[model samples]
Target: MKALVIGGGIAGLLAARVLTETCDDVVVLERDKLSDVPEPRAGVPQGRHVHGLLVRGGEIMEGLFPGLYDELVQAGAHLMDAGEMRILNPLGWVASTRTGLPLLVVSRPLLETHLRRRLTAKIVDDVHVTGLSFRGSTVDGVLTRNGRVDADLVVDASGRSSKLPSWLAEAGITVPEPDVVDSRTGYATRLYTAPPDFPVVIAESLSAPDTPRGGIVMRIEGDRLMVTAQGAGGDHPSREPEGFQEFLDSLRGPIAEMLTDAEPLTPVYLFARTASRRLAFEQTPGWPGGLVAVGDAVCVFNPVYGQGMTVAAMGALLFRRHQDFSAKGCRDFQRKVAKIAQGAWALSSNADQSWASEHHAPGPLKRAFGWYMKKWQVALTHDQDMFARFVRVVHLVDSPAALMNPVVFRRLAKYSRQDPRRGRRRAGSNPR
Candidate 1:
């Protein structure tokens, strides 16, 4: 089988590598001239900002490419035990417990470059996928600017801005209207050199009934730090140096002071128009055959949660299991992945909805669940088990249902009132 993967981002490249094992030949089509080294491209706008491969994401990447974790660490990616780091939940400080899995922190470019080198396939750059080359209901290949390339399957791993829906429509497939949850958020990121002892510090001012400002700082490759601050709605952060610092200070805690002392590396990179979008591809009854959509092309979540790469990896794994380059296989694959995407989409967007002035009232179930989850967040500040469970869901190692399981809830109920004063004292000692 020949596989033609559209978009050369992480999802496309990873899918190509996996498909190459089962297919006769694999080709990746990328619109932008992807950088061979660790650098930003026009396609991945979020590459200019901070990104972290959660513990679950790292594990999946390793499964795809053996020894990939060490390869990334040696390339300047920082691997930190989630337990050693301090985390502040909406309620308070999340208690530290050793989560055996470690998160990999690096610029998106470094990770992509490493993956590209390992895959050993020449990424066909500068070619834009214009449409599908199909025969009746079967997709034969993709029509690109360079011309047509024949294939048995065409996987649209294109990022969020994918034109596949339009292409499919032009090819005569009517897609269902996408489910869009706009957060109307903006992000500004800058690089800094921090104290060697305290490399990465994450401080968040979570969205509440009143405040909706948040920020994250992580130790990336090159011993540098990447800090990003986000404001809800049109609460945009200024691009000026002084104003940027002020924005950081306006965040909940010590991030402002820590950033003030760190050595500045790059200018502030600003990104706006962030919205959680989910395309209901599974609901399209007339969906075409031999064509599949993966990655952000299917669902784009708020990057603040850092779920994109991990979710994409999981989606690729799903494709391998459910899709066999057939039209019906494509439809089944979309439906299965859509179920996974909806869970993550709800998790992130529902959180975004909490920004009071933003005005997103979730349904009764979401509202009630959100209320309990907030209590769980408070429980996480004091209970190690709760923190572990919360992180498990955040990293997608476990399903959201796991957090709501009777086991976790029963534990939370048992421990919430056991020892508040003692918990605060112990948590206070461990400064991030």
Candidate 2:
């Protein structure tokens, strides 16, 4: 068997990596020439922006490419307990405690470059894949700038700018309009020089309605640090130095002061396209055989949630664990992958929903859930157990359902009743 993967990003590379189990030949076609050095590329517009590797994502990647974590650390990636970082959410500050969940802090470019170096499959760079080539109703290969490349399976891992919709339409496949929920948030990132021991990271999330501005101070490879400032609901961070600093200053906490001591090495890079979108390819009638999609090609979450890379890893794992390899099995694969996308979509869209309530009319159940989550975030500030649960959920190690345990429900019920005007009051005070 042979597999062809288009768009040699993390998802595509992972697909190629996993297909090696059943396929003798697997080829990944990437548009831009992938860099050997750890630097941003044009292929990933948000490469310069802040990116994350959730705990579950790190676990999946490590399983796919063993020793990758150690290799990354050797290459200067920061590996630390997730709880060591100081986090400020909409409710209040999240207390720092050891939760044993590890965080791999590295630039998107650096992480990609390291992961690329480990791929055993042949990667053909500078190859622009235009569309999928089908044999009858089954996808057989891909049409590229050079020519058609044959394969038994084709996986579309192209990200936010995927053109699979047009390709499917050409094949007479009718797909419904995808669900799109935009956060309307934008962020600006800048690089700075820092010592090896940069201490702990400081982050303040973009709170909704009342406060929509936030930022983070974290370290990466090359003995450098990254400071990212963000503003949601159209209050965006600027690309210029003065404006970037001003934007940071406007956020709550010491988000702006975190950058005061650091020496700037790069100008601010601003990105505003932070919408959460999902494409229901699996639900479409007469889905094509011998074709599958993983990662942003199928769903894109608000990057603020940091779910993209982890969800992509999960999709890759699904492709590997799947038993069937024939064209007929492709339909099942798409559906299964859709489930993984759904789990992540709920988290991303729900967070953005709060900021988009004016445009959205969520049912009573959803509104109640959203209300509970806000209180839950506040609970994270005071309650250690709740904080741990929240951390695990965010890291993809635990499902959101875990936060709705009977014990937590009782605690939240009690906390909600106490004086609403209590300054900085937190939920889950009594762990009973």
Candidate 3:
């Protein structure tokens, strides 16, 4: 069997890798001529920013491509304890202790480059896919600018700017309208030479309802630190140096102080218009067979959560588990993919919604849940066990439902009676 994967990003590479297990020949079509080394490409705008592979994402990728973790680590990717990273949440600074969660901090380009090199499939760069070729109600191949590439399976692993919807429409398939939640968030990033013994610093500003601004400073490959300043609603980070510095200074943690003496390697790279979008491909009636979508082509999360790569990895893992690749199984597979993305989607969209002005007001139950979560956040500052559970959910290793456990509720109830301001004071005092 032959398979064709659209786009040569991380998602496409992983999709092609899994397809190789069943198909004899797999071809990846990338519009851009990929760089031979770790560098930014026009296709991935977010590539210029920071990226991290969560523990679950790393495990899934390693399962698909063995030795991948070691290869990246040997290539200068930092494998640090996630708990050791200095993180300030809306509730407070997360407790700093070993949580056994391994975080792989690497540049986006480096990870994609490694995955591209490892995949056994043939990657034909600069081939712009235009549409799909259909046989009756089933997709038979992809139509590219060069020519039609006939395949038994066609996977669209294209990023957020995918042309799949138009291509599917051309093939007489009408997909349902996508669910979109735009936070109108923007951010600016710059690369700098890392100082010795620098811990990862992330000062999150989502805690304040009036102002949603935050920043992250983490060491990536090449011994360089990537600092990103984020702004919610219309408070976008500036592309100019002075304004960017001001944005960083406004964050609730030590991110601004940490970068005071750092030497910059790259100019501020601005990425505005970060939104959470999910295509309802599974809900489309008469969904064609021999076609599938994964990664950002299916759902895109706000990058601040650092869930994009992990969610894409999870989608690829789903493809690996599904036995059927035909149109008959496409719907089922897509539905399963949507299900897998739900947790990340909720986590990201909910947070983004808080920054949205036109957001729908939560009902009684949701309001109650919100109240409990606010208390839970305060409790996370004092409760190491609860913080660990929150980290697990954030990494997609566990469900958000775990937060609603009776033990957690009891603990939150106990902490809710105390002065929440005291918890904030403790979190602010930690100078790690």
Candidate 4:
């Protein structure tokens, strides 16, 4: 069997790697010529910003590619202890305690480069995918600007700008209406040279009816600090240095002061295309066989949640587990991919809908979930065990149902009785 994988980013690379184990030939088609060194490229505009590997994502990647975790560490990726990092939850600053959940801090380009090198499949660069070649109701191959690349199976690992919908329509297939949740959030990132002892700090103010803003400062590989300031509801950070600093100053913490003396290594870079969108491909009737969509092509989470890479890795892991390339198996696999994306989708889209006008108003169930989540955040401020549980959920190691467990529900109920004013004061007390 032969498989043609599109896009050559993290998702495409992982898919190709998995296909090599099942198919006789696997070819990855990348539009851009990737760099030998770890550097930003035109393919991934968000590569310049801060990217992280959640605990579960790192574990899955390591499982798929042996020695990958250690390679990243040896290549200078910071292995962060969740307890060591300072985080400002919606209610207040979380007290630091070792949770043993390890996070890998590395640039997107660095991680992608490592994965690309580890893959044994053939990667053809500078080839743009135009459309799909279909035989009856099954995809026989992909059409490129250069020529047709025939294959037994075709996987779309293309990012958010994928044209698969239009291509599928041209092939006389009607897909389901996509679910979109726009956050209207933007990010401004700048690289700085930091002292060796600098600590990673993140301050997040949950989106409410009012505008939301946040900032993070973390040490990345090459002894550099990546500072990102985020804004939602048209309060985006600016591209100028002074404006970037002002944006940081406007966040609900001491992020601006923390960067006061850091030596700037790069000018502020702006990214504004943040919206959570999910394509319900599994719901499409008479969906073509031998075709699958993974990663951002199927669902794109708000980057703030840092779930994109992890979810992509999880999709590839799912593909590895299924190991069936038949038409019926492909459809079943797509359904499983949709299932795998549901948790991350809920986490990101619900948070985004708080301030985005373009998103549909939350119904009673969503509202109740949001209310409980805020209460859960408040409980996290006072409870270490709750914080650990929340971290696990965020990392995708545990299902969202874990948050609704009887024990958690009891604790949330107990914490809800505390004076709301006291929680507000506590949150306002620590600005750092």
Clashes of each: 2, 0, 2, 0
> How far is 367's C-alpha from truth in model 1 (Å)?
1.8
**What C-alpha lDDT do the candidate models reach, one value each?**
0.78, 0.81, 0.82, 0.83
lDDT of 1 by residue, 333-429 (tens): 8888888776788688777776535475678987887767666765777778778877888888888888877887787776565554444333223
Residue ranges of candidate 3 with Cα displaced over 4 Å: 426-430
Task: Order candidates by lDDT, high to low.
Answer: 4, 3, 2, 1
Candidate 4's TM-score reads 0.96
lDDT of 2 by residue, 47-124 (tens): 887788899999999998999999999988888988667777766677567899988887898889887899999999
Model 3, span 71-90: residue lDDT tens: 98899887877666677766
- What lDDT score is found at residue 21 in candidate 1? 71
Residues 1-432, candidate 4, lDDT per residue (tens digit)?
A: 899999999889988888888889999999999788999989898989877678888888888889987898799787877655677765667655678988787788889999999999999999999999988888999999988989989999998889999999998888898998887889999999886567754555545655388877878778888998888877789999999988877766666766778899998999988888899888777788889999999999888888998899889877667877666777788899999999989888887787677657679999898888778767877787888888889899999999987899898898899864466434334433
Provide the TM-score for each candidate, comma-separated.
Answer: 0.93, 0.95, 0.96, 0.96
Residue 102 error, candidate 2, Å: 1.4
TM-score preference between candidates 1 and 2, better one: 2
Candidate number of the best lDDT:
4
